[model samples]
Target: MEAKKRTKIIDVLGSTSVGTQVLVKGWVRTFRNNQFIALNDGSTINNIQGVVDFTTTDEKILKRITTGACISITGEVVESKGKGQSVEIKVDQLEILGDADADKYPLQPKRHSLEFLREIAHLRVRTNTFSAIYRMRHAMIFAVHKFFTEKGFFNIHTPIITGSDAEGAGEMFKVTNLDLENLPKTVEGHIDFKEDFFGKETNLTVSGQLEVETACMALSEVYTFGPTFRAENSNTSRHLAEFWMIEPEMAFYDINDNMDLAEEFLKYLTNYALDNCKDDLEFLNNRAVEEDKQKPQQERAEMTLLERLKFVVENDFVRLTYTEAIDILKNSKPNKKKKFQYLINEWGADLQSEHERYLVEKHFKKPVILCDYPKDIKAFYMRLNEDGKTVAAMDVLFPGIGEIIGGAQREERYDVLKGKIEKMGIPEEDLWWYMDLRKFGSAPHSGFGLGFERLMLFVTGMGNIRDVIPFPRTPDNAEF
Candidate 1:
């Protein structure tokens, strides 16, 4: 006999064919009163209820149905006699696919703390909160590609292993094949990278911006969405050793055009989530509201998740120069009262997350695009302003986590870029090919990088960046 095709819990619940027969498979969320089963297959946040006749079904088989147990139920669809859901499965044939010893399973029917859930990250998605997040994550990822492709941008795959440090941050995970336990050193006592796999030193890429910019030289509009590694030794809620980034490079665009694109792109993504992932968003929004209520009243979110997303989509971002922001920060209540953790004492001070959040959540009451940052603080390739004091750089600040996207207009001048490279102490040979873009035919190109995890945090209302990613690689935690 041919095997029965399994119907998804989402489809089963959506059907009006009350007497239609179907096969459903999912992990049991709960086995209530030994008759009703709350089943989910990660299709949606909500679960499909399965009703079984306890009097007729074998008690031995019923005993195996517990929380986290995988089961296949062949039954007829019927209108739910319950309140929460409209339809349920009437089980005629039930089989335990995988029995979960209720006592051994990490997940329970009750609400599990986020901190506790992180310990079992592998099984966390089986729960309602994480299942919703991963589903929404898929929608966001799809929307990212959809948005860029619709904008006439060619998607490019940049290499993960590279020789040059794009950000000049100096913190990178070196890619190698040489036996570390053994020894290979040069006469200078430095590890001989020349003898390594790549014949020269190579590290996991920190940013695909530099490489994608090369493609922009010919493609006119190109973007890269891929993993980026940073070996920064910080284990903060916001920091991650490995994260994904979405970078778009345009050959003829300037800083102003970059800002406009960033705003539109963000709005498009949030709108996509609102439209495509409404069920998941609604669950996450309620979760955020409940989470917020536990916090001190003054420390709670001023706007709920849905409202926050709408604020970005419905309103124009407030744009100002870095100098203007500095002046405002200096005179602001937090700075005057010495409440800021990092006081705004100078014009060239790097704006931290606190400062960025202040500009967005408190001062502007809307998303803000900050431009014209001090040249010294920004990347070397950023366009040098006429005044020679700042660069044509811009950072888009959102309400919850502050800076979500950072970009700048490229310094197209060969001499100027070369000078900035030297001044920064970066080897000229390391970026010889990058300089060639300027040498051959460089236009006033511009691009910005949106941290995918940070965007996920804002979209899902998740607190830690680690929770937003499936397997978070932090400072030392790489366990599966």
Candidate 2:
């Protein structure tokens, strides 16, 4: 009688009955002298150790097998002697599916710099660090959907291309089809946008908050999880030209409620990743954080994935008004050199990244929710507070990652919004549809935009934004 083929190594390990025959297919991560093969089935971060005795295996065929070679194996579960984990597989039969050239393949056993790995973005996912990061990213995405879906929020798809600029920062990647040779031009040789794709002009969306507000007015609670593009020329670890943003808009909500929701959502996501992607997170903690000693102790805590997550989930996030934060910064230790970073003492100046990082990582020592930013520094749609000079906007700052969430209570009063738009010199005609929301039956609504990549960065302990995303799009680098 023929021996029955079994399930994957992952499933076999979970079963009570050891020594069960199994058929597993995976790429060879490492191979040793026709005696053993370390294979990964992509089922989990843990690779199943396969022991193949050379006496039974063909030496000629074993010579052809190399790292990264695809193969299928019929094996029996056995105890592992290796340091990786408890389980291993004793191979009964091995079949090489495809050969991988040891010299030509870019990935080697030695560590490669992230910069070099980025150049070969197509193959980086196969690496342990990137593989773990991408898996955690997938888990994080699902967790986001689950969190919003359970809360009765509607998932709305906002347009990628829009006629009106979302952020009004004038940093947009233009979309046009006017050929240079046959372009429509005015008498002075300036290109005319009248003949362009949208008849006027259009560009990729910077945020979906505006459109999400429109949907929230109808659905009462709506969110947009989509790709947002910005043409800003910032070359930093925190900035990306094209990235994902999660904009959740709620009707009849205040800034406080918005902050609460942002805090809850983040806690949920971190918990979800901790619960669902334990192995991957462990791999990241051991492999990624171990190399960087500068990583904070709170970030490096070895609490079982869930424990680390529960720390944030169960605890109340620290809250500080922008005014209070400014006061704290002013009263910080009497170091003259450190004071230079806080030079913009007065209100209205945009909070710099360094200030944000210091506030969360140093002052708060936990996730900090900073609210009531200066109206002049905030977006036009934010609701003005009773103070008259500040707006009801908030940013949630995490320890390693700064400003994971930026949100505000929107201006619901038509007159106030119109006046603000006019004062900002924005053409009212362009925002007619947005104004309509207030004109009809606008109630006080609030929302926030969470940078998805930054969240991934926090979860994976990845320092650079480019390292988290599969294919990073930057000013000069857009390679696949």
Candidate 3:
């Protein structure tokens, strides 16, 4: 009989089948003394260390191989001397699949800055940190589907090219096909929208809330998990010109239900990543902890990836209305001392990132749901509260990540929605279909859009939004 194939790192550790032969294929992460090859098969989060002797393998072949080269080998699973791991592979036969030039390749065995890695985004995934992050991102996508599908929510696909601005922020990236040379110009020397591809102005969607709302009214429960774009020029670590958002719309739900769903969904995702991506999390923990130790003690005291996730899983999130949060900020020591970058003075002003981070991380010390924002500060679609000044909107702020999810209970009353639309200077004719939802059979509906990349940042303890995503699209930095 042919020799039994080698087992995977995950299976070798789990099974009682030691001293068995296995076949493995992976890229060489690192090589030591021309004897051991650190192999990762992409089958599991951890790589298997393959110890090979040059006496058995051809010296010419072994000398030709280098870092980042793909190889296949047959080996025996044996006990390892590695500090953290238990098993390693002793290889008998080896084949080099690809050759990577040692001098030309950008990724060396040593550490590289995040900024430098981002410059080579195409090749960064091969690194340990990025490999783990990308895998965690994939796991989160599965968790999102699993969480919603288990709850009987339908996954709906909204249009990418939309005619209406969902957020009314006027930050849309326009979709146009009119030639620039002999452009169809009006008598006033302005580009004519009538000559555009869509005949009217169109843009890449900023949010799918409005489209999902229409579907929610029909499907009862629906979600749009896709890319959203904005043309804002801000270059903060948190903001991306294009990002992924998971927007779930539910029929017959109020603002309270919206908060509950957001909390539950976030917890579900955190739990999912903790359970499914243990090895990846372990890799991330080692790196983050090492980096944290080099920082000041005060900064290092913030929650680790595992600890933050456990906190979310174990505790019930604190929920506060915008008015109550304002009162707390008014009476708080941070505001009194003027420690934050932006002041939290009144209820009508939008909450700054620093204030939101302070409330959740410093004061609350956990995830906090801030709801019932000022009507004038929020979008026109939000339901007006009984106080007439605040809208039934909510933003879920985590310890390190502020405003991971933003949503609201939509206004279902036709006349009220119409009046607000008109007063907000939004062309009433554009939202006729939205108003018709209320006229026909609109029920109390609520939903939230969780920035998927931001959620990944929360899961991986990644400091920036750009680091979590594969190919970040920021203003003036669209290099693929």
Number of the predicted model whose lDDT against the real structure is largest: 1
Which of candidates 1 and 2 is the stronger one according to lDDT?
1
Model 1 bad stretches (over 4 Å): 1-3
The C-alpha TM-scores of every prediction are 0.98, 0.93, 0.96
Q: Which residue runs of candidate 2 sit more than 4 Å off their true CA positions?
A: 1-6, 187-189, 294-311, 334-344
Models ranked on lDDT:
1, 3, 2
Each candidate: what lDDT? 0.93, 0.82, 0.86
User: For candidate 2, lDDT tens digit of each residue in 1-480?
Assistant: 224654665675566255667788888888876777878766676677888888877988788667888888876778778786688878888888888898898887678989999999998887888888888888888888999999999999999988888778999998888897898988889788998988888889999888888889989999999999989898888889999999999998998999989998998888788778877888877665456455676555443333435556777889989998887766666223565454655555677776776776567666789999889888899998888899999998866556788999999999989999999999999999999999998899999998999888878877789999999999888887
Model 1, global lDDT: 0.93
Clashes of each: 0, 0, 3
User: Which candidate's TM-score is highest?
Assistant: 1
- The candidate, 1 or 3, that scores higher on lDDT is 1
The Cα RMSD of model 3 versus the native structure comes to 1.8
Candidates ranked by TM-score: 1, 3, 2
